[model samples]
Target: MVLRPHGGEKVRLMVVGRKRLPDAERHERHWGFVEAIADSAKDLEKGLRAQSYGTRTRGERTQPAARPAGEGVYAVTLEDGQMHLSFALELPAKPGEVQKAFRIAPEASYALSIKNPEKGKPVNAGLREEDEADYPRRLQEEFRGRRFAREDVRLLDFEGAEFILIGARSNPEAEYGLDLDTHDEDYQHAEVIRRLRMVKSRHPIKPLFEGRWA
Candidate 1:
């Protein structure tokens, strides 16, 4: 598995890692990881709203459509000043059912926490700290030396949740059709309208873009 920031700009911060889940039940555990992040971000945004200080003001939640079978990605944004912090997750199944774990760029020094059934656990992997000067060298060393990426699978009762804190990753990708510089009110207004519709619905429905504020 390889990890790189997407769109090749400042730091898109995307992880193209792989995992394995054979049946439908196993897949749901992975999905739960996505869900837990959404729920957690929502709760955080609400708290930010209540504080109304340097706290997050407007926010949006979105869950993109499922990618191919066993592939999922999620993103959330907290509108803070001129910058928005985006948190995202990507999950893909690999081969075998034996448990194996891999950590990518763990030493990059950002607040890291896990939100799963157990909740709030610190991830003490070697890569979680930020070694500023050696980052680029470290990234190449880790990726180049790997003869094969570790892919593990298991009957996971809980696949666990992945939580990431992010600053705006260089404006929305142009493909998303968002013009960040224009300051268009229509886009923001439309988002709010759509979110209202979703919130009013009684059923459990996932948005095309989850964890984004309207």
Candidate 2:
């Protein structure tokens, strides 16, 4: 991701060693995100809110869509500066289910209490000093820092369509003291909107431009 600050100068992100997700995995993830958003919108159109559960027909059971497993961190602003932390907990367990797990980027937490997040929801991540109480011996031995990123997967209305936007607080710009004036409420949101122009040509959603949320 490239960030153009106040001046016209651009600052490109450089990773030590970037690992690209396999073509198959990337396609699956892209489709998964698209399907999840479309499914929720379909339910909403029928006046049925599909958050925890879904609305089904006579004999068919509408199952909750499966999203990419693991944690997603997001930080967004609202009209009145209210912190809206939205989370969707899904339980996908059956006989023949596709369980593909992908680890992207450097996760914020120093250590995780739950060894496997693909199996269930986000548990007590031993990221805080107080979170030491969660572990039996890990806390007693090593010191865990309080700094950790909170994540969220939100459905953002792009143009007239909705898209799944994964947000995480542990962005490289913030970590490197580059994008530091974090007081602006819509800092992240604006940046995301601006960058959508670059993806308009290839992304399936075809996000044209930013518009008022309808």
Question: Pairs clashing in candidate 2?
Answer: 72-151, 72-152, 73-151, 73-167, 73-168, 74-152, 74-167
- The C-alpha RMSD of each candidate to the native structure, in angstroms, is 19.8, 19.4
Q: What are the per-residue Cα lDDT tens digits for candidate 2 across 27-146? A: 221101111122222222222112344356555454432222222232233313222222111111110122222223332111111111112223542123321213334322222232
Error of 2 at 6 (Å): 7.7
Model 2 has an lDDT value of: 0.23
Evaluate residue 153 in candidate 1 and report its C-alpha lDDT on the 0 to 100 scale: 12
* Separate clash counts for every candidate: 25, 7
User: Candidate 2, after superposition: displacement of residue 34 in Å?
Assistant: 31
Model 1 residue 176 lDDT score: 33
Candidate 1, superposed: residue stretches over 4 Å from native: 1-33, 36-160, 166-182, 186-188, 195-214
Off by over 4 Å in 2: 3-9, 15-102, 105-190, 205-214
Q: Could you tell me how far off, in angstroms, the CA of residue 90 lies in candidate 2 after the best superposition?
A: 20
The lowest-lDDT stretch of 10 consecutive residues in candidate 2 is: 109-118
